[model samples]
Target: MDLKKLEEFILEVGAENIPLGMLTITNNSAAGQPVSMDNIRQTAEIYHSFGIPFFLDACRFSENAWFIKIRDPKYANTPVKDIVLEMCSYADGCTMSAKKDAIVNIGGFIAFRDPELKQKIAQNLIVHEGFLTYGGLSGRDLEAIAVGMHEAVDEDYLNYREAHTRYLGQVLTEAGLPVYMPTGGHAVYVDGGKALPHIPHSQFPAVALGNALYLAGGVRTVEIGSLMFEHVDPQTGEPVYAPLELLRFAIPRRVYTRSHLDYIGESAAICMKEAQAIRGLRVKWAPPVLRHFMAQLEEV
Candidate 1:
């Protein structure tokens, strides 16, 4: 969050009304850009001054630490684990999806302070998740999460993980498509609004490109665009769209090797060349909220 804008909002809305502040490292919605160490510390200070609890949605914490090590000069030589600790030190608590940073197949965990709060969370967990002991996970799953959590911060793993994501971005960029710069931690985002300029954003160009990528080579991708982030005017039934229309190729950790990325690059290159042939999509059916997940769209 931008400190200036935050202060303005706080002043307008009154600080007492604010309950919490949350930050997502390698922000998923921002094409995976890392939240800088400077930004993190300053935001913590601002939130603390306002008596607001600060938290992290640390899904990609490991990848974020890796980005900090390479991108920021002050932490250029800092170890990944130490960086992770320091980053966490600035937050009151965090939520983790093991599927992302920990590389686990399933399950997630929460980190927090305040003993009374912990008890409250445990009580809530029992109501929905299960016994707090293992949250209903098998012993093998628990073991994998424990080991994967540590391995996620390993130096070798961090290097390869970042490199793989960057390589895909480089390849796609070379193919003459617009890719988000400084390649983020987990995926390469193609600016589909630019890639398929002939198809207007109103018609869901990003979704069309994602569908094209899949049909071209059986490669799956997700659209981050108007369809996903748009808001609706309830009274008027007017649709409001997001600013950027992106299509992401999120690479799974330790899954595909060099050849796989090369194949994706070639497929994307073909998609770019044949972009004019692709058609935008219109929502055939949608739910009242969060429509992108299950909405049915047909070619326009």
Candidate 2:
């Protein structure tokens, strides 16, 4: 969930007096640090103190479930499905990213306990998406999601993925590269703050790291910082907050093996050891008429 945006929305809705609630805070394992559950709870408690009904974005419930089990083995016997349902009870409604937790190629869903709100939301969905019969997803994709959701909790599968992440983290750490301890989900984070202390945030640390890694080892990585919003112009665009420059290395589940991870670690180490400063370059960007994905960029 975009908590910053959500908080702003809450303030706008005149619900500043009402309490907000969130299930759990987990990091964008794909990004870097875990989202703080304590922070979320405090925010929710504040809203609750004001007598407002709070809702959680529970799309990543499965990941949180895995985290809980791994972090506290005493709860290992708890069923993830049950945990998800229980967590949903705290929220007025939830928006789920079926694609991630459900492992389907394309699917999403929203759940609410309030019948009136549920009906209203469903009505809106029917107009924007398809009817409940179709649910804006293909039948095959739904099937995949169902199967994937079931497999998402398998201890063996989760263990393998977790081990792989740890292995990647260990390799990078041992190589004396700046890495976040306690890797999250299925990604390893290269701490841009520590990796490139000399680089300023305004200079796009994540982008610099990504480009450096690519040049040093031919490995592709994405920057989580300012580079993500490179299209925004200083004069015309709004300012961005949070760490915009994070170099993220996402490990695909059941895809890349240990050997592949080793190669990635080796590449990262070499990049850290040999990276050079990047000189600034400026270019103009035009907003896309259609999909930005389809838009082409060329040197002017």
| Number of the top-ranking candidate, with lDDT as the measure | 1
**What RMSD value applies to candidate 1?**
1.7
Q: Give model 1's TM-score versus the native structure.
A: 0.95
Identify the runs in model 2 with alpha carbons over 4 angstroms from their true place.
1-25, 29-51, 73-77, 215-218, 228-244, 277-300
Model 2 agreement with the true structure over 1-300: per-residue lDDT tens digits: 465676676677777544445443345634534434444455556556556766766555666666766565655678766655555555566676776656666777776777997788778888899887568888888788778878877767777777888898898787666776678775777777567777666555656676667776787776565534444447969655335356678776677888887887787778777655543222235345432223222321
How many residue pairs clash in each candidate at the backbone level? Answer: 0, 15
TM-score of each: 0.95, 0.76
C-alpha lDDT (0 to 100) for residue 23 of candidate 1: 91
lDDT of 1 by residue, 1-300 (tens): 789998788788988999888999978889989998889999889888888889999999999999899989999889999999999999989999999999999988888866787898999999998999788788898899999999999999899888899899988888887999978889999899999999888899889998988988888999999999988789999988878998888999999998998898888888888888999889999998889999999998
Q: Model 2, residue 169: displacement in angstroms?
A: 1.2
Q: CA lDDT of 206 in candidate 2? A: 57
The regions of model 1 sitting more than 4 angstroms off are 233-238
Best candidate per TM-score, number?
1
Would you list the C-alpha lDDT of every candidate in the order shown?
0.90, 0.64
